[model samples]
Target: MVFAMLSHAAIAQDQTVIEIQSPVLVIDQDRLFAETRLGSRAQADFEAHAQALAAENQRIEAELIAREQELTELRPNTAPEEFRAMADEFDARVERIRSEQDEKARLLNRSREEARQNFFGEVAEIISEIVRDKGAVVVIDRRDVFLSADRIDITEEAIALVNEKLE
Candidate 1:
């Protein structure tokens, strides 16, 4: 009778262990961001803004070059003091333009970061929903796992959920 009881207890313990294992789902967050509609739109907007900034920088640089060329042409004919004043003014303008451009670049970076944070916030909620629906006890980023079966990956499902929620 003791032997049978011990065997029954061991079987129950094994069953509990099996139940505790649950399921682990992996998500490729990079893939999620790259494939999602919202992410793609954000990327496109950022690229467009960056291109506009680059064009404006080019225009300002061209103007600076023109001013420098004009200064070079006037240098020999102009009085020393007058030439010095023009050079000083040109240097100051260049500095001001550079400062403004730096500030604009910093603002763009901050905006991009904020957008990313918002995207991740939405994704986190979607992931939680998916975990509950799929009976998964743990969800890990695919990048963190060195070896995982493709069957355990829920990236596509997660992306679908994200798209549905975001849209």
Candidate 2:
């Protein structure tokens, strides 16, 4: 039970003017990636991976619980010094496991972010093409814009094109 003691623990807004000199398009970039085939597939893949990680954590927790029980059982018969060393080694092992698991979680989050960014990059060219076709100079995230007129937004159009063009 002593080994269990050691291992533990653990938005913004704004809006801007609509009509500028140059044509501006707004994209719900989140929606765009979330809707496309590539984005959808990436998301599903990452989610599955995340679930696997969760299962792994649960498994580790169970194993640790069992280890703690075993250690507790041995504590009474063992010599004080020997038990202390055993506890210390057990603590060290737990620390390493924690560090490794934490790193894995970080890597998972980083990979998810990187996948999102890469999806955005892949869609960027599609966005550019739409921009050129519409004679727009700049595109803004839909969430950022304070106000905007209808028909100017090319998010839906971009999504359509992205799904159509990319796998």
Candidate 3:
């Protein structure tokens, strides 16, 4: 009896077919490719900027460290006014470095925002074209779609169509 019940359950599971009405078509290719290219460009730009900043920071930090070390070693023989002047200079340098870092961060954020907008614009254009050509009643994210027939997967066609436009 238990074996029979198990067999019946398995057969039911196999027969189960989910159907989606007004099935949502996802243009993942457009999102994926567009975002990928934009992100790559953004990352490249970011990396280049970061490397420049890093090199500059390293030079500044090394200079500051050397100065401090020299001051420490010379403290025994150094005059009070000279020591005070060196300390003040170090403080000024620190403030300048902090301000520069803050400005770079703001610039990086602005660049990223611009890149994201550009990627979205490219993706939207492809989606519009696909909708016009394929007569897609609605386009939705794949995550929102519960089930769909394989035949209705217009993703490849949409990708091809969009690539043509891109080229």
Candidate 4:
């Protein structure tokens, strides 16, 4: 009689366990960005800016190398105090240039981040519309998931929507 009672209670408990039936959607942000027109434009612009900065850096580096060679050549012929002053001035200049280069690199990184934020801002709205249309209760990045069927992936759909909206 006790075993029958316990079995009935267990069945009741199992019946009470609720299961979520909501749909889940997945997006591949990297693919979406690369495939979208606005994202492609942003990438090209960023690349051009990076190339320009690199060329400028190379020019500055060449100038510094020349200055260093000149200073080395002058050290042998110059008086002790005069050579010390020149050496100190050269060291100060090199430090200043390094600081400037560091600042430039930081600025480039900031610009890249800003561009990404702006791109995502626009993409978010489109994603929302797609999510609602598909009746998905939750959205997850494709990169974060270990496994998902292609049918559940919304990256291509999101990319299409983004391009259509942006264009």
Q: What lDDT does each candidate get?
A: 0.86, 0.84, 0.66, 0.84
lDDT of 3 by residue, 89-112 (tens): 878878898898779878877876
Give the better candidate number (3 or 4) by lDDT.
Answer: 4
Give the TM-score of each candidate. Answer: 0.77, 0.81, 0.59, 0.82
Pick by lDDT: 1 or 2, better one: 1
The number of the candidate with the highest TM-score is: 4
Candidate 4 global lDDT: 0.84
lDDT of residue 72 for candidate 1: 100
RMSD of each: 6.5, 18.1, 6.5, 7.3
The residue-by-residue lDDT of candidate 2 on 1-167, one tens digit each, is: 55454333100111223332337888888889889899999999999999999999999999988998999999999999999998998899899999999999999999999999999988888889888877789999989999977557777888899999996
Q: Which stretches of candidate 1 lie over 4 Å from their true place?
A: 1-24, 145-147
Task: Kindly report which residue pairs in candidate 4 clash with one another.
Answer: none
Candidate 3 lDDT: 0.66
Worst 10 contiguous positions by lDDT, candidate 2 = 8-17
- CA deviation > 4 Å runs, candidate 2: 1-22
Tens digit of per-residue lDDT, candidate 4, span 1-167? 99999999997665433112237878888888788999888878888988998999999999989999998999899999999999899899989989998898899989987888899898888998888877777889899999976667888888888988899
Ranking by TM-score: 4, 2, 1, 3
Clashes of 2: 1
